[model samples]
Target chain A: MSKALLYDATLCIDCKQCEAACADQNKLPYDDNIAKEERQSEHKFTAVLSKNDKYMRRLCMNCQEPACVSVCPVAALRKTSEGPVIYEANRCMGCRYCMAACPFGVPKYEWSSLNPKVRKCTMCPDRVLAGRQTACAENCPTGATKFGDRDELINEARKRIQDNPANYIHHIYGVEEVGGTSVLLLSGVPFEEFGYRTDFPRDPLPLRTYQVLSKIPDFIPLGFVTLGGIWWITHRREAVAAAEGRQAHQAGKELK
Target chain B: MKIKFTFWKAVFLLIVAAGAYGTFVRFFRGLGASTNLSDQFPWGIWIGFDVLCGVMLAAGGFTLTAAVHILNIQRLKPIVRPTILTAFLGYVLVSVALLFDLGRPYNIWHPLIMRNPHSVMFEVAYCVMLYTTVLALEFSPIVLERFNLQKPLKVVKAVLIPLVLLGVILSTLHQSSLGTLYLIMPTKLHPFWYTPLLPVFFFLSAIAVGLAMTIFESSMSSKHFGRELELPILQELGRVLLVVLTVYAILRFEDLLHRGVFHQLLVAGYERNLFLLEIVLALVLPLTLLAIPKIRQSAGGLYLAAVSVVLGFITNRLNVSITGMETAAGLHYVPKWTEIAITGAIIAVGFALFALAVNYLPIFPEHREAAGPEAPVAAKAAVLSHAGD
Candidate 1:
């Protein structure tokens, strides 16, 4: 089953137990005061973004059709069949287009290292594959974060919104955004208030790119034929003009 | 025969020294120390200027070659060799700058052996590689002649037409592909520079810049190298620039209108100001200047127009790569002193190499060769027979 995470902002107390757990799980240094160090970084794969007295986790959404996976020239980043988008350091030449392409701006680069790699949440694939929850979800103290099969998680999230219609926003954050992310979120207020982009097109981003690229086959032949025609016409005209000038000069000499 | 120790040379040396230090730090301490690049701003002026602006500027090579060799514009032949040399040097410098920019410079060849046809960057990598090779091959006849290697010259000459055609094809592919590289960044890039037809815009603007660069390089060469100005050809180039620039300007406005973002142009902000400045200086001013017959004919007028176009292209590219992404990055990026020094050194070294090539090689066809129809063939045959000895 494809694992997914459902994060409910109403339940999160901003304790940051998940942040510490993720850091420990990934072997990165854990910060004592994570609220002061809010955004996700090279060392912090997940962080709770505190805004307007509300808390939200800021990590890779791991899109169903990730722009990073689509844009990586060497296939360094791949969305695993089971779930989660994973990166292989061995194949990465560090172009960082992945950093540019991620809609959430989730990927971070190891800029300070002599050999840098793109850093992001892998969604704890090893733990998930072992039939255990992700480090963050497993460590959550308030049951704010939960992990299970994606379809079941989506149904569970919907059930919460249905049961607490007055308390919840009556909408799932990731069901249709950027063609659906594996990580879903339930919020008390609007998602845009917490810096989440609510204006994305429902279709995957790469589909738009593929639509443009699909026209290349038509463009190449047309461009070549057009360029060739211009070259031929211009050269033919010049050649004819030169020939006429030569003939006129020879005729003038004969008349003289 | 003697070189002078001038102020500019002194300045150049100081920059190279500082840049050498920066490069040292870059290799040792990595990108974080030498550049202003961050997780937020992973690309800086090194990409904005060195790779993007550099490749766009070097476009004169394919454009001029296509005009002369393919379009049968015989008068433009005098400028072709010099333009190609400049382009070859420009691409070489771009490659060097890219090497510094990549975090794993040693694995640069991964793009070559690895196949990721779905990726736009994959296409860009292949095009850059193929086009650079094409340029080198296109440039080799000059070196062969300089060395008086007739047999090799004959062999290279046999393939010259095909090579030029291939070079033009490859140039078109990558010049447009550079824009395609940004297509994935639709949300990150501001709507002002981002359009579905970005590749079209990139291709069109490249043609304009390519032509303008030829005029700019030619005029500069005439003044500095004591070569006579091919005034008529330069004047024709100005007219062509007017046409191409007009088309580009119209397409730009049309794209804005199509996207219903023409109102964005009126918004009171820094991006608006920069966008307006880019349009006025790069497009409108040059177009107005080149449209006048008398102004187009005058050397000064042509030079000014060409310079404006070149500057405008630089601004457009910089805006697309850097300024457009700034808002998305949430914090602004200012290039470190080291970044400036390294880029300056790269340009200084490119100029020095160009000067050296002009001094030693027969880049400019002789005055007699410029006047005579058969001069290029005669000169090559002479070099060939000398090599036969």
Candidate 2:
């Protein structure tokens, strides 16, 4: 029920404008190694992925039944009504089982800090609930990271691929990758080249966790002894009782 | 029951403190602070050593119990209670170890309250809880009978079979599940450790480990208690272990061949060396030692073989969970000091409990004929029958 944003890296411009806006808005320090070292980097709803010939924007795809939410063990991570994966750090025990379980590796742990929060792109659920467009979409200079309903986004992605065959790959990056992420991408090169897993599974990771867990009967044969030991004890008690009864019989015969 | 503080008691208190400290740190901070667990190797020593392999090593309690009780071999009675206590302690350690790995220890109740039928973790949680309770109930009569609570003991005795059967069923589900937990990570697991038949592999290894543990624990306990051991039955148990280990070896390679990952085993690396070590220690060494009566009859030889087999099984599990796991992206892992301390403390508690149980409760058999090497089946059965009650 949440909406996801898709970014086509070919359209990003690495002007550092989005990063500046995000740092200012999120109260994060400017681009400096000290802030990074502090392990307190505030995650932007959208990030302009740096160090490549073409700029890539990074953000959460707002997966349906998100793996982080599924493997929360507790409902620390939740999917809001409007379709955004949100976090409640206070209730979180900081157990990063969610980080491991996510196939996309979307959740980042604040490892250096005594109190760490899992950092990821939240879909701006607070704004969406208030009937506002996301800050990332409004601020995007090239319209690379789009915000819209998933249905409309996919249609838009398809139309772009059809309109400019030379500029776009026929496939949308997140549309079918891992069971159709809310985000959709239209790009010139293959998804694999862009550092996105194009062949990821649509099936939620929890099911796979379950499939292996179900076959645990491997220890049952060993448990047979629990019952057998009980049986042995019972027999031993009976033998003791018999021995006592024989002693009483001998005493009675001696009295006769 | 109050007396001078014993050596085992001191050790137990240390374990409790270490375990408590680990939990406190986990609650205050997070898993990264307390463990070497990472995105690459989410399941570190806790899952590999504690849950996967520890349970199998603990399998001796049930194997010895079944041999003595169900088979009417009375000779096995002396070791039964001690073995059960060990098993109970083993399960407790495994359950506690799980808390270290869980992200939200407080929310552990959510799984019980909110049933996720599809979650492998759900089954593991349910079985661990159920089996732990079953283990406690099964062990209660020992405490009760000692206290002269005839009525409670009677009630327990009446329901023993069904409770044990329930335990067996639950054990089957969780043990195989430990192996099955890795099945989905086909890409993550090294070829030597992976296959659709992972469940069967886990099952076989557990049986062998259980038998080997009985051999080792029994022999080791005898050193402390000075009770005469029924060495012949243990030799027979060793033979059973040989069969299971042999089958397991064949299947290990068979699974690799089936999956076309046979070459993966020979790829010169740590994983390959670890896998080879597991085979040589757990299977080939024990198998060769136990095959010839000359070597098998010696308590020293057989006991060494059993210890090696147990070590081998631990290596096998490590390979399955740690050595073989392909991370999302990263290098190899090493557990944090807190994690290692916690694991060590857990085994110490197991030994402490075993020591206490053997000392106080009737753990060892009273007296038995010394085997002059060979023992016919009838003589063996007779020796077993006269061992305890």
* Highest-TM-score candidate: 1
> TM-scores of the first chain across all predictions?
0.86, 0.75
lDDT (tens digit, per residue) of candidate 1 on A157-225 = 999989999989888988888888889999998888778888887888887667766776686677677
Worst 10 residues of 2 chain B by lDDT: B380-389
Please give the CA lDDT of all the candidate structures: 0.84, 0.67
Task: List the candidate 2 regions with Cα displacement exceeding 4 Å.
Answer: A15-47, A69-72, A75-83, A86-95, A110-119, A126-135, A188-195, A198-204, A207-256, B1-32, B38-42, B62-76, B184-187, B293-298, B326-328, B367-389
Best-fitting candidate, scored by lDDT: 1
My TM-score estimates for the predictions, one after another, are 0.92, 0.79
List model 2 lDDT by residue over A24-101, tens digit each.
555656765432332212344445544446555556667766767755544568877677788877656554656656
lDDT of 2 by residue, B1-389 (tens): 22445444455566668867876776676777887765445567877887787787767665655566455566666666767877888898887777666555555566666554554556667887888898898888777855668998999999876776776667767777677666555334666776778777887787788878788777855654455776886777777877887888888777777788766666687877888898899888988997888888888888988889888888888888777764334477888877877777666656655555544444444422222223222222222221111
TM-score of chain B of each: 0.93, 0.86
Stretches of candidate 1 above 4 Å error? A34-36, A217-226, A229-256, B367-389
lDDT of 2 at A216: 42
| Candidates 1 onward: DockQ, in order | 0.64, 0.22
